[model samples]
Target chain A: MIPVSVTRDDVAHVARLARLAMSEQELDQMHGYFEAILEHFAKLAAVDTEGVEPTSHPLARANVTREDCVTEPMDRTKLLANAPLADGECFLVPQIMEDE
Target chain B: MNDMADDIGLLNRPAHELAALIRSGEISAVAVTEASLARIEALNPTVKAFLTVTPDLALEAAKATDDALARGEELGPLAGVPIAIKDNLCVDGVLCTCASKILDGYRAVYDATVVERVKAVGMPIVGKTNLDEFAMGSSTENSAFFVTHNPWDLSKVPGGSSGGSAAAVAARMAPLALGSDTGGSIRQPASFCGITGLKTTYGRVSRYGLVGYGSSLDQVGALAADCVDAALLTAVIAGQDPRDTTSADVPVPDYVGELTGDVTGLRVGIVRELMGEGIDPEVRESVLTVARALEGMGASTGEASIPHIDYALPVYYLIGPAEASSNLARFDGMRYGHRTKERAADHIEMYSRTRAEGFGPEVKRRIMTGTYALSAGYYDAYYLKAQKVRTLLRLDVEAALGQFDVLLSPTTPLTAFGIGELVNDPIAMYMADICTFAANLAGVPGLSVPCGFTKAGLPIGAQFTGRAFEEGTILRVGDAYQRATSHHTSLPGLLGAGG
Candidate 1:
């Protein structure tokens, strides 16, 4: 069950930590949303996974073998044809110039 | 013969028959492509399913297929079929935004391995479809740009983050679509939208061009109106690729040839943990119906417990978000994606403003949760603990699989809910993956097929999961169940329904 009292401040804290700039209205709306979410997550607290060791990956299988042979390269012209901003044989970028 | 014309008119015709028509010169590839496009145009707007529709490209590809056939060139299986790709898949020169604002303008320079294979076999891509932002939520409402509604009912959600893929196939917008399942993205959506979806073993199919979410759990799968079509698409795309490091070295089995629907002497386990508590009664009945159907088909069915199954959702929340945070780190509004312009600011300021403006709310939530879980003080307590627990969860399935060929469960606890119902409650949204997440955690194969519909006409799906690399078992079970019933054959009453 999610908590009913989750505040806009809690959502703001989370947004700041996430490096997001949310408006006050969005924060107010998100508080009620987060509260419901926390309640739903609270159900997991009742679940007992205490002694069970947590697994990161499901596969016990490993050691996929592969040949080290080099393959032909994809045509560079074709590869870079779709770049939105490009220079001659290179991708262009905004310059970070100093104004001393 | 005009019989070819009538045959091509049927939207749900089996793949093999459609292939025969194309090969025998009775139906041109262009005809099938046009039929699919016309169907999409007729229904897609109401459904809000497709993000992009590539009519020109599809027609051009179809013309190329017709030219090839005219020259006596051999077309591979599923030749000339039009299929849609989930926006998350990289299609060179096409937008592959994963349905997010951050990647609004980003296009891939290369095709994903699966996309390349399908194209090589002469399948034309219809377009990219909608999904949750970075394939995160259980409903497509989380999509940054649009909400894809269930074709069966407009007010209800089509499950996510592959909702558009499932809905597209359900709406007959495409004969088939490829989807990636991370904690039930493919199967849940399939169940909700009433189609056949398969989540192959983690490495069974190459993940070369799929934008990463949970790398270990995500496997590219297929959505089709029927099992045979699903098998047909799976055969073409399932194979080893040097580009994706995790792609299996195993030989690609003749999946099409092996669709015999014969499962005599095979052991099927009904996971007891999944049936009780919170699951809708209708979903449980549907699972039991399929189990009984399989049992009658000479497969022995019994109840088995994967005790740690309930912990899957919790473990997934930790692991999926952690991986997502890291994977999405590349989208700093630097290379390509929606970037906010900052005046009188340094590089860091530009980066911060761009990211803040680009990512949606759910994406931000996951990134924060992931960052906290992997942060200095909490890494040992949360992230490491979750990884260890994942191994234990996998062992639970291993223990059960020791006695059974496959496990059975309701693909989702309920059918499609109202769109905003779970979105406001993120935990509830996460809970939607409870039944399907275990297979992702264990990196095994899972398939969801429409078993029955609820009293209100919503679809209920039954999932069959198998041991790693034993996709044969899962497919066989699904084939057997589908053969025994007309559930998978039934289509949404498209009379006034949205696609």
Candidate 2:
């Protein structure tokens, strides 16, 4: 079992980190679900990887170097034209709170 | 009127016939475009296959093909044929939703490499097809927008992430459609919908501009009415693109030519593990027929055991979700996607509110599962063990290929289950991928061809596996079998009947 207790406040905290806004109903529903998820992951904590090296990719990793070259980019006017809302030459966004 | 019905029908005709028609002036490129759009309008609603339609642009492209033909301009194969692109692929001026609400309104500024190559060969884009939200589920039921039903049985789901593309091709809404296969997204749905689908080698087709799922496993492939059409479309789009770092720089051989090569003297392996367990009897019989047909063509067939397949489903669950958790981090609502608003709250609240509202339950479940798997103290047990399992599974395929040129199995355990049968339980849903998951873990190519129909007339697909970069071999055998049999040619009656 997951040793950590996931309180409603904890749910709200992780939600904030994940950028999810949960209603009280959702938070209550997820409380037990999150606990179950944590327990499921707790199964992984039992494996021994003391000396195993971590691999990020299955294929060979190398710098994908490209020549310093110049080429025509797609027309910016055409590209940004589809943005639902835009400012002068850039996408527009609603203001976020300073703390946010 | 241009009176190019003869010419255009050539566009919609079987690839070989279309090739002959193109050579004979019986049809022009423009006629095919009109017929495809007319079909799309009539079928898309009942099937919910397309997320966006581009008729005006498609006609313009068709006219260009006609003008070029008049000038005696040499057209490449697939000229003037209309093809639908899955919504996951970036099409300039079209919304590349990946069937997720997060990017619902986001239009691509440029075409994906595959899109660019296909257009260069004179294939008009009919539209963007629907898919699971971020290519997540087996059933298109997880799509944020809507579900794409099986053309064979409307109440059932088209196996998905690429369901809409498969359904479009199956319904004859479009002769061919492009789909991205991350897990069994293409093949499983192709099985369910009664169409031919191919998951090319990981680097065989460029992934540039494909919204990343499991970046290591995803591939762009074709869903078509038959293997010949699949081969034609695959040939045009299969090539290395400089923009995709993982793309292989190998030369694309003439897949069409390979189709005509003798299948005699080939060693075909039927993976014994995928059979004899949970496989519907009808689906198993269909797989057996393909084996018998291959043996008749002078190919040797026998059972090969892949012991590690038992571990494949679990490994994929771990790796797929782990990668998904990381990749989906980019959709934080600030990057031109669905963003939630809050009043007088901190930055954390802003993020929590946005993601909770934007993501569907399936997406959230995966994200949470992945986050836990990657969290401190849990990493070694869950993530590390799964990686080792993935390695073992890959080695199984490597050893099997040492003995056989290709491996065979039923594409899915059963034909299309009812729409709601497996939706409620996530683990049950994940288990449906038991047979097909091994290929993704092994990073190899797999193709699903319509082997036969169940007594109820639903299609069963036989999957053929090849070593990396050997899709030509699979297509060759599939095309040969299709030539000797009428299974792939048998279209679902209603889909082919006029809308």
Candidate 3:
């Protein structure tokens, strides 16, 4: 069963974890949506998965490894072309270190 | 020659037939390409199937194919055929938006493996088609840009997240298109648009350079005018690729060559759970009709119960979003895609604002759902439980397939819904994928073929699902059904009236 009713606080907390900035209105909306979706998912609680092993990848292939060799990478200019802000060679972003 | 070209009905011909015409020197590839472009110009305004139309790229590729043919070079199987790709698949130098603002201004630096394969076979890609944002949601209404309309009726949606690809083929904008199926994205849309769509086994087709949404569940496949064209395109794109480790090492079958249309003595199982209750009467009737047709072809049919079938929707919702949250993490403000214009105090603010601004409501909701599911305290209750249920679903399918050559069901519970009808209700929209999602969860091949039309003139599709690596069998069944029925050949009234 869905143990907890999704609150605005829960939406806010999850939104933060997902790096999303939600307004109060959006948070309330998300909370309702989450509650409904989670309630729908609550049906799975009835299935007795006593000794069932989880299947992540549908086709069970093991250790898809490749040769440890270096190959030519994509052109740096082309790779960086889509960057929102780039400083010629690297992506430009807001300050990483806060004032201490 | 020009008059002959004009009368060729270029848009309605199958991809293989178009290629054959080009090869035989009856019509130039340039003429065919121009004809398709003209159709796109005429119909795309109403259909909204394309996110980006690359006329120059299409014409250039078509000319090259003609040049190769003129030089007496042996052409590939799909040579000179016009195709469209769902916007999520990367095509080098073309805008590859997943119908989300997050990917605005982002052009892929390289082609997806499927794109490379299609290009290698000389298929001229006319454009990138629209889809739901990051391939989330069941209808193209989730598209950040615009919703694609069903060709059969302009007021209704072409089902999604491969809506545009399906609509493109259905409207005769293109003969073949590629769509990725993660929880029935391809088949559902094909069903809605009255075309053929194949969702290959998980490892059957390479997913390299496909923008990830539910990584484990995703398989790139074809949406074509008919099952024969679908099989031909599948053969060109299905072999193992070193770039994608999940692509199976199994030898690729000549899917076109396997279309002997012989399903005599094939054991067909109709999943009782999928047909009862919630399914619309017309949709259910179409499925039954297809079953009867199969029985007439000397195939035996029986009711098969997959006890866990009802649980598939909840399982898919949990698992699909969980993977999507992880896969979509790359689209922060710094590297690529949309970045917020507002000044931010620090990097975190920029990241938050960028994501908030870039992603659509459905995409954001999915990310939140996934984050919540994978959160520390709830992991076992939701994500893990969903995975375990997935195992049960797979086992249930396996047990059913053990007794039957293929399982059959309606592709969608209903015909194409009117746009905006279910857009506000996410649960109602999610329910549309019920019949198709189980195949994805079980890692099997499923084909959607046009079965019949609703009295309202909307298309209904029946799904044929085969066990793992049994695409040939399913295609054979689909082919035989098409041979027996005229539903696949019937064009939407919109196409005839508009043209």
The candidate that achieves the highest DockQ relative to the unseen native structure: 3
DockQ of each: 0.33, 0.33, 0.79
Regions of model 1 farther than 4 Å from truth: A1-19, A22-54, A60-98, B1-8, B495-499
- Give the CAPRI class of candidate 2: acceptable
Q: Which portions of model 2 show Cα errors greater than 4 Å?
A: A1-17, A24-58, A71-85, A90-93, A97-100, B1-12, B496-499
Reference-based lDDT, residue B107, model 2? 88
B-chain TM-score of model 1? 0.97
> What is the i-RMS of every prediction?
4.3, 3.6, 1.3
lDDT of 2 by residue, B385-416 (tens): 77865676787898998899999999999998
User: Model 3: which residue pairs collide?
Assistant: none
Evaluated with lDDT, which candidate comes out highest?
3
Q: Report lDDT (Cα) of residue B89, candidate 1.
A: 96
The full ranking of all candidates by TM-score, starting with the best, is 3, 2, 1
Q: Per-residue lDDT for B133 in model 3?
A: 93
Put the candidates in lDDT order, highest first: 3, 1, 2
True contacts kept of 2: 0.27
Proportion of native contacts found in each model? 0.37, 0.27, 0.86
